[model samples]
Target: MTPITRSTAQLYETDFVAWTEKTVQLIRAGQFEKNDKSELLLSGKSGNKRF
Candidate 1:
């Protein structure tokens, strides 16, 4: 198989933000888990700490 080159990889990387947003949307829609550690790390409104 042919290797993915730097330019091709860069193109994908440029669209990564949009990809991540779509993934999160899918997770929220119950399609899958978000796998979002940052969201888990944020403090809740009641000041509860989350791991």
Candidate 2:
């Protein structure tokens, strides 16, 4: 996992492609701590789910 820098929730709708690319890059880099787990999780799902 790689973490991306904090971004507003609106950014996902405003530029989904860029956001996805940035997210992929961050994950590939192994910067897990920077990723926003809450934002990534589906509503009603537990954050404890792990790979």
Candidate 3:
């Protein structure tokens, strides 16, 4: 298997502002849960789940 690289991992880590913007967009688009409970339940373990 190919070894993981720092650049590859770093690409997945977005800055705070970018992350916040994307999350807001998703919420507004109705792509994410509307309620806190539903959101928590649907949240992923890591960034991988978000993708």
Cα-based lDDT for every prediction: 0.72, 0.66, 0.58
Those runs of model 2 whose alpha carbons end farther than 4 Å from true positions after fitting are: 1-14, 41-51
Higher-lDDT candidate among 1 and 3? 1
lDDT-wise, the better of 1 and 2 is 1
| lDDT ranking from best candidate downward | 1, 2, 3
Tens digit of lDDT per residue, candidate 2, span 25-47? 88899986776665564434664
Which 10-residue window in model 3 sums to the lowest lDDT?
34-43
Report the C-alpha displacement of residue 50, candidate 2, in angstroms: 9.8
Please report the candidate that would top lDDT against the real structure.
Answer: 1
lDDT of 1 by residue, 1-51 (tens): 999999989999978777788867886898755555454444678785765
Per TM-score, the best of the predicted structures is 2
- Model 2 gets an lDDT of 0.66
Q: Which stretches of candidate 1 lie over 4 Å from their true place?
A: 1-13, 33-51
- TM per prediction: 0.37, 0.45, 0.37
lDDT of 3 by residue, 1-51 (tens): 998799866766656456667777877898865423322334456533322
